[model samples]
Target: MTQYIGRFAPSPSGPLHFGSLMAALGSYFQAKSQQGQWLVRVEDLDPPREQLGAADSILRTLENYQLHWDGNVVYQSHRHDLYQTQIEQWLSSGEAYYCQCTRKQIKAMGGFYNGHCKPLNHQDPAGCAVRLHIDQPVTEFTDLKHGQITLPQALAEEDFIIKRRDGLYAYNLAVVLDDIDQGVTEVVRGADLIEPTGRQMSLYHQLKQPTVSYLHLPLALDENGNKLSKQNHAPAIDELDTQATLLRAMDCLGFAIEPSLKDGTIEEIIQWGVQHWSISQLPESTEITPRFSNGSV
Candidate 1:
């Protein structure tokens, strides 16, 4: 069997914290153990949230942690032309339509676009966006960790927007395009993304693209039980203790790591970890906030 190809795509909204390490290490080891090529891509498509010095700092942090990736880094911001081409293609094929619905209107309509603009013959004026037409999404798929998951009837039937009304390509569109372009055979990331995977899979069917395997690892949450995100003010990982941090992340993934190796080198420890990497040991599918093992140590 051919080896898998996986990627860790982090947005430069803020520097990586321990939560980020969990996803990176999880995906990294999965790819490495399978003799697959692991790649890194900067999801800088969302410009407003992007930090000025964060991208370079992020690369530096990855280097410090020895989470090196293969090949040239794919920057989403630099690929706007490709996105525009696809968006225009979808529009021309009548697969997408123009929408001018404001957030306030959607809020008043009980959330989600009520297809208010779906029948509009109006052209996309400046600042307007396009939305993909969706039929009742009754599609079912299997997830690697969470087992046979089923989406709600209402959620499956919602006509999702592919391009945002803000003149920016929506996440669903970009993620599908990027993954398709990169030939991604496997998607290993945090479980917070599990909900979106079904929608992306739908788009794959629409575009006639191959679907990739998904493994959504347990999310790293904060004291508030919210996922540790840069937006939630999760402090960046302490680069000075990258190896220790990686070890702690491993523990969060449900490994009974030995104490003697807690302070070992990142590579040395990761090699040992790959030998013991057992996906079956992961906790039940639920939100989990990561806690550095002061107790485990």
Candidate 2:
């Protein structure tokens, strides 16, 4: 039987919040339940958005919550050469082309790029981005948690960018490449990213690699119904009370953990969780507001 491999990839844009913690816990529980390897990858590709020391802080929080990873942590910032190599190969094979279209121009075309620059075949690297030529689009895919998901035709067929004009690789390109490099068999993440699954699957097909399984857990929403995310200034998880926060995260993933386990050590609680975790128990809805006995998360 093929070994199951899962990963928790967090970007260093900000500290870990309840939403981020849910993703990490979901991925961790799913992997450990199957006796699979759980790897950690720090996505620090965008220099301008990353916070200094955020990566170390995230790892520390994971450890404090007893979500220990299996191997040496991988950083996207260190894998630029690999992304570039793939882009070069695609460019040579006519699978990708240079694009100079700006966001405003794309918006003018009713929000999705119509591949206006592909025929231009602009060879100059300066002031241009590289886009994947989407001759065969992946319109739909099945999720381990959500079942079959269908994507809009415009979104599925749009020729997306691989490398930005600023020389940074796009998230879809970097994430898919990194997952392939780590031999990740399943990707467990937040439901907010469900839209990108089709695009990532398309990239996998273009690379001649089999698509990995996806399990997008329900998103944690704030009181205002906004997603609890770094961009929304969501407070970081309280590392001081790791037990309570860990329980809240597990609850968000639909685990009815016993109250007695809360008195146990963090490791013990995690062990109990691994034995009890089941993907079928997870909420089918996309968003969920975490419940707390006290007025705090």
Which structure among the candidates has the greatest TM-score?
2
Q: What global local distance difference test value does model 2 have?
A: 0.92
Per-residue C-alpha lDDT of model 2 across residues 48-147, encoded as one tens digit per residue: 9999999999999898888999989999999999999999999999889999889999999999999899888889989999999988898888998778
Tell me the TM-score of model 1: 0.93
Candidate 2: C-alpha RMSD after superposition: 0.9
* Model 2 bad stretches (over 4 Å): none
lDDT of 1 at 175: 82
Per-residue accuracy of model 1 over 82-151 as CA lDDT, tens digit each: 8889878977887777878788987888776777777775574576777777763635667787877777
Model 1: lDDT to the true structure? 0.80
lDDT, residue 296, model 2: 60
Best by lDDT: 2
For model 1, state the Cα shift of residue 168 in Å.
1.6
Minimum summed lDDT over a 10-residue window in model 1 is located at 288-297
